[model samples]
Target: MLIAVATYNEIDNLPIFVERLADTLPNVDLLVIDDGSPDGTGDWCLQEAKVNPHIHCLHRQGKPGLGSAIIAAMKYAVAHDYEVMVNLDADLSHPPEMIPLFLEAWEENDPGATVVIGSRYIKGGGIQGWPWKRHMMSKAINFYTRWLLWLPMADCSGSFRAYPVKLLKQVDFDSFLSQGYSFFEEILYHLKREGAQFVEVPFTFVERQYGASKISLQKAMVAVGTIFRLGMKVWFRA
Candidate 1:
């Protein structure tokens, strides 16, 4: 299994992130996709990758979108012959400890678990430290995506997920339209269209403890528009 984390300026969180992953998933290889963070996050990953054989870094020239970074990680995982690929945010919002549960879920299921999602809207799942406005907005986005895309899952917007690399290779990732956070839902839609089976695991999403949010009003607006266009495309195809 290959675990991938996309990072920006997450200097404060990287140490604990590496330590916990090492302690928990000692055998898994890690790919850090850094988009040229000004705070030396990429440099730190380079140093660690030199010392730790399990750690690898991909440095970009500038800050690219979240979607591109994960796509890059996916390619790396496939090229390296990893059976499964897992992606998470680097700001500690997605817990590194849940990796075991994801693996277990993937292994226990027969054929219907090509994708396992860490969902926040499920019964046992929840979020922490977010203001009511942000919380409500997240809920609204999930609801909107589920209805528009006719998706079965509750948490379509989440980035923390595990995918079988074979399932990932079935899709042409270069055809993906969304270049930011909206890519989460768009990719799920594409996978569902390919008849990929999915499982949702409940998890508590904690707010980032370090640095500011990468989301902006402009990005949110773009995501909304992208969702609408994707909805139309899927609806017409159906």
Candidate 2:
């Protein structure tokens, strides 16, 4: 499996995050997609990639959104013949330790199972170090999405996930509309339509220890409208 992390101004977190990821999955390769960050995150990744053969970095000219970065990374994984791809936050919010469990779930699942999500709303899963407002916002977003789209997922908004490369290749990436957080749920909606089996593993999500969250109140409000538009599209397709 190839682990992919999209980074933008994550200089403080990348070094230690990559170190721990290497310790957790010694053999798996890592792909870091860095958007041009004035903080020199791309430079750091390039320096590390030179010494570590398992670490690969893709540099973008500017801060393209998360969806585009992941798409690019997935393409790289596919072109490189990787059978599985795991994506997590560049920040420490998504624990590197839970990576093994994601791989285990993907390996042990039925042949049709293609996406395994690290869920915070499931049993034994929750978030730590978040204020009550943020927690409620996350819960409400998940609930709203699940209810409107008739999604069976507990964490549709989470980015921590593992995907089978073959299954991902089947999706029309160019048609995906969202370029930010909305992509999380949109991808799952398409996967569900493709009859891809989904599995959720309980995992505690930690708040980012290094940088500030990219999510803004404006983005959150925009997401509500985006979700409704996406939901309508999904409903019509079904």
Candidate 3:
């Protein structure tokens, strides 16, 4: 398995996240895709990779967006012939300890689920530290995405997910329209078209303790537009 994290100016959180992940899953390889953070987050990852054979880093030019970073990681995983690729946030909001559950779910469902999501909207799942407005925005986004994209899962927007590399290799990353957070739903929509099966495992989402959120009103509007366009495609097909 290749565990990946996309980061930007997450120096304070990356170290703790890495340590916790390493403690939880020491045998897995970790890849850090950094967007040239001015705070030297890439530098720290490069330095850590030098000593830790299990750790790797890929430094990009600038803040390109989370979607591209994840797509890059997917290509890397395919090239390396990893069986599975797991992605989570670098801010520790997605707990590394829950990774084993994802893997277990993926295995138990052998030839059943192509993706396993760490869902916060299912039973036994919840969120902490987010304002009511943030919660409403999340709920609304998930509702619309599921309704429009025809995704059956309860959570469609979270980044904590495990994918089969074979299924990823079947996807054309270059064809993706979403270049930001909406990539999550966009990819799932495509994967669903490929007859992919999904499994949702419950997990709590804790707010980041360090660094600020990268979400913006502009990005949210873009996501809305992208999903709407995709939804229209679904409508036309139906």
**Best candidate, TM-score:** 3
lDDT of 2 at 220: 82
Q: How many pairs of residues in model 3 come into backbone collision?
A: 0
Q: Give the Cα-based TM-score of candidate 2 against the true structure.
A: 0.96
Model 1 TM-score, 2 decimals:
0.97
Scored by Cα lDDT, where does model 3 land? Answer: 0.93
| Local lDDT at 45 for model 3 | 94
Candidate 1 vs candidate 3: the TM-score winner is 3
| Clash list (residue pairs), candidate 3 | none
In candidate 1, how many Å is residue 103 off? Answer: 0.7
TM-scores, all candidates, are 0.97, 0.96, 0.98
Q: Order the candidate numbers by lDDT, best to worst.
A: 3, 1, 2
Q: Which sequence of candidate numbers ranks them by TM-score, best first?
A: 3, 1, 2
On residues 1-238, what C-alpha lDDT tens digit does candidate 1 reach at each position?
8999988998899878989898988978999999999998999999998899999999988877988899899889878878899899888889999999998888877433379999998999999999998888888999999998998998999999998887777788888888888999999998888888889999999999888899987898889889999999978987
Clash number for each model: 0, 0, 0
- Please give the lDDT score for candidate 1: 0.89
In order, candidate lDDTs are: 0.89, 0.88, 0.93
| Model 2, total clashes | 0
User: Model 1: residues >4 Å from true position, as ranges?
Assistant: 111-113
lDDT, candidate 3, 1-238, per-residue tens? 9999999999999999999998999889999999999999999999998999999999999788999999999999999999999999999899999999999999988543369999999999999999999999999999999999899999999999999988887888888898898999999999898878999999999999899999988899899999999999999999
